[model samples]
Target: MGRTKRKRLKKYEQNSINLCYEEHLVSLQKWMSNKGWKNHKKLSLKLFPETGRGISSKITVGANEVLLSIPMNIMITYTTVKLDIPVKNIFTIHESLALFLIKEKEKGINSYWRDYINSLPEKLPPLTWLANEEEIESFPSDIKLNVEYTTTNFKNFLNKIRDFIPNNSTLADSLLKWAYVMVNTRAVYVDPHIICEESSLNLLKDEPSMALCPFLDMFNHNYLSNTEVSIINEGRCLFYELRTLSSCKKYEQIFISYGNHDNVKLLTEYGFFLPDNCYDNIKFTLDEVLKILKFNLDNNKYKFIKEHDLHNNLYIGYDGVSYNLKAVLFIGWCGVINRLDSIIFSSNYPSLFLEKKLPDLIKGLLVIKKNEFTNDLRQIMSGRIVTESAQMVLEFVKFRIDFISEVILEYR
Candidate 1:
């Protein structure tokens, strides 16, 4: 009985794949005709033999090219409620509705819009699969309703695009507007997975432009990978590449940038600290040093390491860590004397300063005992507190506020 059931499930899955493939091909042909492409057979030959069984295709208009792919086999599982009926029933309803709309559009029958909106009540079954009547009641009724509404909304959008194309607008412009509409309306979600080629053209211009490829449109890939291709007389245009098997929802952080190099530079510049060779044993008049530190602290400029002729290449040790102590002290002492809000410390080893040494230094400064402070500071340099380093850094920042305030008052 188990083997029989497995065989039946395998057949059902294959049938679903075939249905999706047929529907995709039909939609692609209709989209091509709508765009006024005359050589269907020739173009079909160029685009035929898709890279895989999935909904994927490449499109070229004049010199512009784009690759599109969709992951139709993706499963969305809802965990809060379980129904006695199989989940595939719900999937069938959604898939059937999508395929029906595509068919209606190809037949050029506008009335299907009204029919689709009105037919939702009869098409969707009740939540009889739920374990209890109360569970069914708690299920979101609006979600089921919105699914139908979204179908009608999509029909209206396609109609608008069809109208816009006949008005002599450029295909690229029309496709761009349509992509933005699809995204903003949330009718389809684009997967965030992206793979950018290093040699790609720079398409980030002041105004937006995008070319549509029907195969790419199907997948809803969120991170639109733009590939640069050079064409005669037209210069360079960005093309969308084929989608990968990876899933975007798994990653916690998403970074989108117009270009790779520019984004990296932005990250590094913001995190960089001034080098240590800028300060040495330069005698400052006690009054002068105090004033400089105070001004630097007030402006949060303690992290700015400026090179001075008097202290060229000289470095000093602080908290048993080798740093330009003169530069660090200048910044820290200024902040200490001025009672500044939010002192910014930039260091090449910011993680080290925060985690290992800064906490003990602050604690020692507050108590004004050199020997106790030196003993605690030694533990950091010797690597005994390596495991708790990050935690210590966070705590040190929290503890420094009181010490800073006290030092300012004492100096005043």
Candidate 2:
């Protein structure tokens, strides 16, 4: 099965979308200027039909053109927080930053970041937003686990900072969560080596490794993007195109690679998934696969797996079954291979254990998972009032299933 593609926005649709964010861009441009940052002027914020908001070219950009440069003071970093408050902090980087955003939120129109914050999404639709138990239950195991993990972190953070805020109870949990999501989705990794020598080194030492870039955050991700972001020039970070975007017409969307992240990483961290993502794959925990195989894990083979820490590194890719899966299967079905030999063979030559029927077995398993994804899609589609965000979750799951099915066909 071929993957579903994202539809291109018509010219009228683009114009309408551009009008929606024009006020936002105007306000944000002033903030950039106030902070001494330089805008390339060749780029503009445009709405992509496929990826919502993205940066687009206003003119023909050449190879190695520096698109934008954000000053260090403009970034929301651990240093930024420290400069605001001289008192030593007990909170971790993320907690402190979340608190910083909450403070800014409390300031309303008085806040220096009012323009940027106002432009932020009023509602972040991560699993955190799913209030009903039924809605939560409908998600797949992997997505459910991600939600649980992030929720736990959020709760822990709330506990630590609850006493710090005056009238803390007045602060809505949803606002803090939205701030947290915003930081997670937008922050860029700033390396220590790139820090300019003239800047105050005190904050740099205590600063978190990540910092949020204002206008730069608007660049949507593409796995095949030729643009690269670097912080080496002076104290500022710049985004530049590596290849000449000759193929891209005027106003065409240009993207930055957020590292070759898979669909799961993108969805969990950024609240969106790429349609027909090339990096898409089905992940299976060892215990889940063991349950599927119905293998009693108390044997010496299982002990060997635990001793070497091989049990955790297992999954299925779009290409075929993972090597770890083959090893465990060989140990379970054909015990002639000892633990070490099986491990070595699995690492070196997994194809040796590929059975004629293994693909069919996997196909059957994938079908079961695919049905689960499709059933959720059907439930959402048939609803009286379903959110577009909820519908996106279904689309992501359907893409995963379709990708798995494509792999299954290749094996057959």
Error of 1 at 297 (Å): 6.2
Reference-based TM-score of each model:
0.24, 0.80
lDDT of each: 0.28, 0.64
lDDT of 1 by residue, 90-180 (tens): 2222222233333333345453233222211222111112113333222223222433444355455445445532542443433333332
**Which candidate number has the best lDDT?**
2
Instruction: Name the candidate that leads on TM-score.
Output: 2
Per-prediction RMSD in angstroms? 22.4, 4.6
Cα-lDDT of candidate 1: 0.28
RMSD of 2: 4.6
